[model samples]
Target: MTTLFFDLDGTVSNNFQGISRCLNFALEQLGLRQLTDLEVLPFVGPPFRESLPRAFPGIDTEAALKLYRERYATSGWLENSLYDGMAHAISTLHSQGFAIALCTSKPRVFAERIIEHFDLAPYFKGVHGPELDGKFDRKTELLAHLVEHYKVAPENALMIGDRDKDVEAALHVGAHSLGVLWGFGSRKELLEAGAKHIVDRPDELVHTIASIA
Candidate 1:
């Protein structure tokens, strides 16, 4: 069976509400200009360490991260909703015997909490993510760590996510990638990132993963 690695934020849950809230809170704390939710949309897929610096030039990345984490750890994490049909899709995948796991840029502690909150823990065999200290912050490094720890061959894994980084990370690790359209990324971005497959809906995930497998 192919090991299916799923991204957490945009792929499974629409975390924009929480992410934007935390982001704006940090910006406000730092006296930076606050951006609208739309302006904050593009930064949802990547890690804050990378996205924050891009979103606000000359901002103290560490300070902003600290502020963001404070709110996120409190109530911001609950400001999320699973994408419609995501729970069903993941459940179906699990029943079909796919070795499913979560591979996300979010910290493991937060990711696990969110997964449990959504009742998704039963479907995932593992929840892989970076630590609070910035280790495995890069997709490539995260995927590599998952591959090593799980002893899954990279070629037999399929990465499914809503961003270019997900596809690029799979490519770097010699795994196939599937991009979902219901998330934050565009078809062009996924294609440009070398995604092997693209599915427009959560309902399409099962068939798409089967095809890739």
Candidate 2:
């Protein structure tokens, strides 16, 4: 079975709600306006340092990041939940002998905490995120690290996620990406980002991988 690298946040955890809330909260604290759901989506998949400046352009970058992280780490990220059937989908893939890895831009401490909190640590072989000083921005760079760390062959690796970033990351690693429509990003965005396949449900990913395999 091929190794599957999945994105967290908007992909599996539906954690964009927390991120959206935190971004809005941070903007509010900065005396700015809250973004609409459509407006907030572009911010979901990428790192905060990158997304924040885009969402709240005039705000103090440092303070905005600080507040966003503080709020999100405290409760915003946790406020989110998983997509239905995600656990089952993961279990089925695992039972079928697929190796699962999490490649996300969330902070390491918070990523670990979220996985543990969600009781999902056992399903994955590895989980990775950003380091201190918050330097990771591009999906291509993160994907390269994941590919090396997982020792994944591009042909045997698939990235499953809900955003364009996930697709970009997969492409960067030379892995095929299957975009899930139920989470954060729109179909157009996914396609524009070069996602060739789309799965409407979690279990559909099984077929997606099988077809690729």
Candidate 3:
């Protein structure tokens, strides 16, 4: 079976509004200026540890993350919704005997909760993500751990996501990557990051997967 690794935010779920609200809330708590939706769009897929520091220099990342989590867990996370046709795509892939799993930069606890909340837990074999301590914050590390722990061969594996990090992570492990255009990242970003294939929507995802898998 073809082993598929999917990114959570932007790829499977549209959680931008919730994520932005929580991030802006955290910034507010830190006495920093709140960002508009456009300003927060780039932060969707990357780890907060890196994005927070870069967006707000000299800020206390740990404290800001803590505040963000506090808001996210209560209401922000629930504000998310599955992308149109994503559920159908996941089910189709699973029924076709693909070994599907989630590999996201979001914290493991939060990822699990989001999947469960959306009733998507049945579609995946495993859900892998970083810890709250930020150990697996990088997509490279997260993908490496998923491949190693699950014994997925790099050549047979495919990473599907919406950002450059996903493409970079797959390349780091000698795996192929498929970038989705419906997400936050642009075509230029995915191409520059060396994505093996790019699809425009969830309906196109299955066709792209079949071509490679």
| TM agreement with the true structure for every prediction | 0.97, 0.92, 0.98
Question: What tens digits encode model 2's per-residue C-alpha lDDT throughout 1-213?
Answer: 479888887678887678778888888898888889889877777876776666567668778778888898788867878788888888888889999988887877778888888888898898877775765556678778878887878878888888888898888778898898898788998999999889888878777788887
After aligning candidate 1 to the native by TM-score, how far in Å is the CA of 156 from where it should be? 0.7
Give the per-residue lDDT digits (tens) of candidate 1, residues 45-72.
7888888877678889999989999999
Least accurate 10 contiguous residues by lDDT in model 1? 47-56
Every candidate's lDDT: 0.91, 0.81, 0.92
Question: Global CA lDDT of candidate 2, please?
Answer: 0.81
| Candidate 3 per-residue lDDT over residues 1-213, each given as its tens digit | 379999998899989989999999999999999999899987899998999889889999999999999999899989898999999999999999999999999998999999998898998998989999988999999898888988988999999999999999999999999999988999999999998699999999888899887
Q: Clashing residue pairs, candidate 2?
A: none
Q: Residue 167 in model 3: shift from native, Å?
A: 0.2
Poorest 10 consecutive residues by lDDT, candidate 2:
131-140
lDDT-superior candidate, 1 or 2:
1
Q: Candidate 1 lDDT (Cα, whole model)?
A: 0.91
